[model samples]
Target: MTQATMTQTKVDNGVNVQALIGAREALEATPAAAQFKWRATCQWVNGTHSRSTVNSFFGLGEEQERPRSFTVDADHPEVFAAEDNAPTPAEIALTGLASCLMGGVASVAQHRGIQLYSVRATVEGDMDLQGILGIDDEVRNGFGTIRVTFNVDADASQEEIRALVAQAQKRSAVFDCMTNPTNVVVDVA
Candidate 1:
């Protein structure tokens, strides 16, 4: 849904003082908040140990040196959940839009040499079941349109920011794709 209707995804809302204290006690075993990284181990399709052609990885959170391991292929470019179940490619498309915007905006800022601190983006798109479910042949299917509401948290003037966005549009290929469709040639390989 768009921001007009976007609400927070539900997370644990429970609050228990004793539980909190116990959790704090458990955390006390650690050095401090500013001194940790998390890691995760991931295993992808096929195998590992130099015999696997699998394209998966692992990572750790801030407390660890790396993330959990997972597999990747044409199916998942961002890998998967450390638990072996991350988001699919489509979820990543949205990420692509945001990332494209971020890169574009940042490039514009940097090319212009603006000392901006942070850039944030809110991306939204809608898809009908017919498109993804392959029920309707008439529907365009994949994201009729994706709207990006950029909330650039930088100390720049509105005029400069607007100019930056304009520059970003001038440079962002994905933005061009959405604004301008890319022609394709179909062939059976």
Candidate 2:
């Protein structure tokens, strides 16, 4: 059977029963060793256009893995004097944030035995390009503020869902990464 068909068949009460069970088992077995490192490579195409490729899932104990290769393109809008071929980097960052939050929501809901009907997250970031353009030295080139709204339909009380969302935010790696400062070293090759 196809993957979609299998998924549909394995779903129970709006949750993927088999997948959740498997994930729980994996987590239980791995526990403290369940850490993972994700890597992506991006190459500049030309004039505010670039492509990124994601393929591998690396972890502490997994010795053999299949390559799941996919590519995404990023480009600036026409107003920026570039072709609007794909979403800008800032847009992609928001996408990543939304996706990570959604994943957290789903996982937490499943663990709490809450059946999710639908979950959606809207993420917005405010930024000023003056810093990037060297027009304003005091302006930062990154997002000045970001807001996220999550709309979830589930078989659970509003208070429960709110608590779940708070827990998810506390546990979400992307959320922590965005909010907390990290040490980054840049080396020119």
Candidate 3:
């Protein structure tokens, strides 16, 4: 096929397939390029309220800057005896998971030559505040169960849609992080 034909076919589902493939190939050639260190700094605003800022990150073997700084505010609800300023940390976690999975679905669908018309997702995390409140020593501080449902509209069969969502879950970094345990060290600096 001609370059134009290939390019045309690669531009699907609002994703630049050619650019994505090129990035993968380049990263494969230089494995170190895939290593990234994402960083965010949080400062306390008041009781049970804090703000986190994101500006730049280390990726592609170098420091990369974003177009502008982004900030996220976290606070508890009135029922929790705190100001209802913004979403809680737990809600933020759910948002991160949903965003990552949706992004994966788009990319995977594009790679498989599928044209996606629309995709919507609902993510739920079941948490027991007993652990966080130190009311029950046996309870866990994190979510006990997390569920995600996707409603996808595309030029593909139901089986294909299911497979697409499954593949996206398999490839999602946030999904893996939530399901698996990682080393976390905390100290005063």
- Count the clashes in each prediction: 37, 0, 0
Q: For residues 1-189, could you state the per-residue lDDT of candidate 2 as single tens digits?
A: 223233443323455656867876987897864777677789999999999988777675564355677899999999999999899998998888888878878777766667678888889999999998999999999999999998888777788789879888888888888899978778889
* lDDT assessment of candidate 2: 0.80
Worst 10 residues of 2 by lDDT: 2-11
Q: Relative to the true structure, how large is the alpha-carbon lDDT of every model? A: 0.56, 0.80, 0.89
- Each prediction's Cα RMSD? 16.7, 6.1, 3.7
**What TM-score against the true fold does each predicted structure earn?**
0.53, 0.82, 0.92
From the highest lDDT down, the ranking of the candidates is: 3, 2, 1
Better of 2 and 3 by TM-score: 3
In the range 1-189, model 3's lDDT, one tens digit per residue, is 223244565436777777989999999999999999998999999999999999999999999999999999999999999999999999999999999999989988887777787999999999999999999999999999999999998766788788889999998999999999978889997
Task: Tell me how far the alpha carbon of residue 157 in candidate 1 is from the true structure, in angstroms, after superposition.
Answer: 0.9
Instruction: State residue 5's C-alpha deviation in candidate 3, in Å.
Output: 14
Number of the candidate with higher lDDT, 1 or 3:
3
